[model samples]
Target: MGLGVERFTTQLPEHLHCFVCLDVSYPPVIVCALEHQMCESCATELRKSSSKGKCPMCAQTMLDPVRTSGVLKRAIEDYEVTCRYTGCKWVGCLLDEPTHAKSCDFREIPCALCKTPYQHSRSVQHMLVCPEEVVLCPQGGKRCARKKRCELEKHLSDFCGQWQCRVVQGCDTRTSLANLPAHEKTCADAAARIAKLEEALSGRNETLATILTELRAKLDSLDPTRHASPPRFDWPAGQPAERTVSTCTLVKQLLTRATKRRHRRATLAATALLAKPLPSPHVAVLQESAPASPPAPALA
Candidate 1:
């Protein structure tokens, strides 16, 4: 009395498959005048294969393919498809299949140069600095290998034996690449000479500093009135003669004091020089080489 009817089905419609490729049609699906749909990629291949550009199913003349309708596009998107890649069991909506394929770890991609298979996304980056890829040494072929591109620079800088010293002014010593630091530390002759020169310079500096201090002190003592301004006198006209005479006497006293201070300074300097023992033979030679003072000119 009753025939069983299956209510629900998740199967994709046959019209949604490309007629030429016999695979699920992806957007933008091309439609013939009879409304027969084909995937865009298959439609292009079919056109290229056929000089007359005929539709595979209807044998009708093919024209430029138009964009698929939104309702059909949505229906295709809702349909689920299993991953085409072998060993991958992922199942998702038709719209997201391409994205999943792009990021899928199990997808195989061939290397650009070596043609070795690798994971899909990492293939391009692996090619860039690949160890198997040959590259020349950066140091103009100084006993360096045409090693891997990633290791070429490191080989020249850190492992090449022909590298020269980096020190600019001193020590032209050239050594092996790894021995540069060790050679710089024990570079004997130049280092010893530099040390001796530095010691001599320090001694000269000390002697100069002592002489400068003595000279400064002597100058200070000699010119007591150096910073003192001359006395300003506002003498009114018709002043007493005795007041004028007193002013002149005061000025004479100041000049006499300045002259005495100068003589005293010269005496003290000479005495100090005589009292100091010469610390080095160089000082005795300097004293002997100094010029004699000329006799004072006769007063006219």
Candidate 2:
């Protein structure tokens, strides 16, 4: 009710009590005498209710009906008092009561961002997910400056273009989309592209190596000298052999020359296809020359 009279170390004078409410009168109104004062709230109510133009305590005619006593208000505020909120142990001069009420832990206050009421003690917890609170864009926050916490997911996928690019070959750099014109020049994505290119080239080389091996095998199979040995015939008992081994030998010689020419051409084509140097370490280098074919068997 009135600033607690019990809180003060020394008892206040009897004149300080309002004649109407019988409580310690704050903002005491001086109606007639200094000894007969009423609380401003009581005086104003009585003025409107009853037109008795007389001071209730001393039966004296009311003169100007003045309602405020600055001296009494100051006297009341000078005394120390404890906080009114239940369980709050804070004690201070009455003048500071309004300031302390705003920050008391047990009191409820509205969030500045969302305007939702919550306990002052929970301010830190409330701010963590407050929809209106501004926060970094979470997906590489360094790029985009700010976003509302409620919009974090939308900002990640739709709004913010900057992202943590894929790391490649132990490079831990990140590049932004804002500087996309120079994207290839930046080492971050450049390293990633290089890694992808190497993978593709490695597979191509493996395929090329297989093709070259197949071509080499086909060329060796076509060697005429490999079939140069003459087949033995079942001779008639009385007749001389119509065809001599020398005749078969001459035919084989012509075939060997023609086969050699084709082998040389196939080898040259393979070499041309593999002319460029392979950069990937995973693929073995293709040599310029194939291993020499075993010397052509002597033509019969």
Candidate 3:
């Protein structure tokens, strides 16, 4: 009763309790010269009842005014206290017990919004479903209006659908900004998807490079004497130095091969270019292509 705890008596040891009232001796524990300890209320009442300052325990003439026991007060303050709230599982010192009680999640507190008292631990559940509660969109920024928590999902889809991600370099982060604990899956994880696409394109690039190297080598072998003389094409009447049919055939073959590979290359390029994340409706992705290496000085 002294501490105003619901189950205060259940945790205190018998030795710490007042001898008269059998309650935990809180601060201001009055002590007689013989060191008999009782609550301040009990000491005051006993003094009023007796003609002389009489010891309650031994029936002896006691000191005129019993002094407050500083030693006992300090000792009791260090005592371990278990929270009085059932199922709270908060164990702390007697000094911190009062403070913890005020902020304990198990304790019922009035909501600032609805003004209805509910257990603070279940605040998320209550806030989401409480008819009186109103919440703002988390991703909608300043544009979205406050809506009932129950109807927030529809509002997010309809109202916050156009909310663009302001992620630095867009897809550079390792995790999605929207993917938080108990948060809705709103935006795509751009980083992870881009990583996968880069992986797939990596092997394809090596293959394309090998093909280019082989073609270049073949072209170099065909024009073995390219350095000696500049090969001349079939010109109008009185043109000098006639070129071979083999050179023309080689050029045709190379063009045919390039045309065939161009479609394949374009298909792969298109696939990479259209990297659409499943969750995102509109994408503002950008990529810079490296300048194409000058085709190995073509020999005509």
Least accurate 10 contiguous residues by lDDT in model 3: 173-182
Per-candidate local distance difference test: 0.69, 0.72, 0.67
After superposing candidate 3, which stretches have Cα over 4 Å from the reference?
Answer: 2-14, 31-34, 40-55, 58-67, 111-117, 124-300
Q: Candidate 1's residue-wise lDDT over 1-300, tens digit each?
A: 110111112556776656666555666465467666777776677677745567767777776654565666777777666765666778876678789888787688877666777767566677776667887665446456678776776777777665555554555566666787777666655677888999999999999999999999999889998868899775444556645558676677668878999999999999999999868899889999999999999999
Those runs of model 1 whose alpha carbons end farther than 4 Å from true positions after fitting are 1-108, 114-128, 135-146, 150-159, 162-174, 178-182, 188-196, 230-300
Best by lDDT: 2
Q: What is the TM-score of candidate 2?
A: 0.34
Query: What's the TM-score of each model vs. the native?
Result: 0.34, 0.34, 0.31
What's model 3's overall lDDT? 0.67
What value of lDDT does candidate 1 attain over all alpha carbons?
A: 0.69
lDDT of 2 by residue, 1-300 (tens): 244566554567877777677677876778776446778777777666665667776777665656577888788777777776666788897788879988788687789989988777778999988899999877667678788888887766665666554434454444555543354346666776888999999999999999999998898799977657788755433534546546666567658877999999999999997997667654434443457679989999
Candidate 3 lDDT, 1-300, residue by residue in tens: 244334442466666677777777765455566678777777777777744667778777665677778877776778677786666998877788889999897888888877888787888877876766777767664557787776777766555543444442453222223333112233345455777899999989999999999998999889968656776643434433445435676667668778989999999998987885464433323223446678898788
Error of 1 at 109 (Å): 3.1
